[model samples]
Target: MKVGVKDLWAGGILIFLALLGLFINGGLLGIGLESHALGTARRMGPGYMPMLVFWLQLGLGCLVVFNAFSNGPDPLERWTKLDLTTLAISVSSGVILWRVMEAIGLNNNYIQVGAPCFVAMAVLAISPAWRPLGLVLASFAIFGLLLEPLGLILALVGLCVVSALADRDHNPVSVIGMTVSLCIICWFVFIYELDIRVPLWPTIF
Candidate 1:
């Protein structure tokens, strides 16, 4: 039943997801005991957040169901319409990227640098009208080149330039600045505060 402002479908689905999260926390389906809000007792477990989440999802789900039934027909699009062509392209492209990289002898688990290159190349080859192919390729290339010399943060900044070039209206300057600023902030947080290494890839300085 559709009741409230937007949609019961979306609301109900969200509520269901929350309930699922709750179930995982609840240890209902052969999971371990987790923390509950009251005070983290014996059977309850470690983290209390999940119990609260379960109650929230159940409550919201009920509310959503009630609203859905009370509401009239939606004035807007009710459900998401699938884009078959785009979906097909996306799936096929991921497979194509894997195959191409393996063929090129760039077989790494992450395949960080080359994977995006292959994907971009494949997309451009198949869909010439995409128009940002050149920029996309240039961006990844520049990023790889800068990755070692400038460090992860600076290289990311360089890549953002390439990203900006992909779209005419994208402001590269602002993006670069933002990227650098975020990196510094994240670096401080991850390094100083959390004591975590920032680099999953090569750590340049």
Candidate 2:
């Protein structure tokens, strides 16, 4: 039996996520789960469903790992030194640029957000095949940073815009439509239905 590289990476990531979820929910270490009651299946608490889901994910991840080890004739993907160098430079430069901009008083929303995205895209552009990866990474990073300050809708818009850059043949109209649709769905699910206390618009405005 030969190890499958793809399966190994997938299973490893899944297992890590499952373990992270369990750790957070279980309140291990100094992390407190706070009022997350674990009610029965009939009357589920916030923790109940998440705990069950993580357990199931853990089981599935274990099965995937076993299959990875038991599978045959799977070749590993090649990652060149250039890829690692590009990633390192992009991340470090973005961080440095962000701090410098803040210190130099050029830290408006446009500069704060645009600098990182531009650096990621430019650095990864050297490897044209991996441009999508760059866009996705930058999108998520920016979204996380912007969520609290800029709010959910703006963060989603930023995410969609940056990620959409990956598709060269993408239409601007379709992109706008998709962004609007995503914002609506997220507002419905996370803000309205789930009642999460995240702001929809920028807090300052």
Candidate 3:
């Protein structure tokens, strides 16, 4: 009845994330759900789905921990110096660049472009095997960073391109189709139908 180290670590992380989400959802630390109500299941408040998800995650994490004790001997993988360096440098570069730009009151296109570039390059340089993870992280970060300066359409396009690049088997036609479909759907649902205030083009335009 030995504990599987890998499963133990995985389950611990899942439990931690679930607890963090529950704390936020329940307003335990005054982080989130401040104004949102926790209405009944039938009524379905804004916090209802997230609370349910966190509970499910907690249950799944507990099950995984239980299984870890019952499962065979699987050890945890050690993070190399390069792995830690890659993560630290990549994340810090983007966040530091963003903070510097915001502090200087220069929320320009350069900050939006530079941050993700730094992240992608650092990840690729240090750990080429983690290309998909790096690409996905950079893509989402780019989308968030560029949403204000470059607008929704360009941000979505950037997201699609970078994310598609993550998959080695991704086709150009499929990427194009997905990009177009996403743009149209977002435009219709978020801007037109929902009347949300969002920019459609570059701020310069």
Query: If scored against the real structure, what TM-score would every candidate get?
Result: 0.41, 0.60, 0.60
Better of 2 and 3 by TM-score: 3
Steric collisions counted per model: 6, 0, 0
What is the C-alpha lDDT profile of model 2 across 137-192, one tens digit per residue? 77877787778889999999999998888888889999999999999999997787
Q: What stretches of model 1 exceed 4 Å from their correct place?
A: 1-83, 99-108, 112-151, 158-168, 199-205
Better of 1 and 2 by lDDT: 2
Cα lDDT, model 1, residue 64: 74
Rank order (by TM-score, best first): 3, 2, 1
lDDT assessment of candidate 2: 0.79
lDDT of 2 at 187: 94
Residue 130, model 2: Cα distance from true site in angstroms:
4.5
Instruction: For candidate 3, give the lDDT.
Output: 0.77
108-198: candidate 3 lDDT, tens digit per residue: 6566556756465546545655577788767877787678788999999999998888888999999999999999999987788765577
**Top-down lDDT ranking:** 2, 3, 1
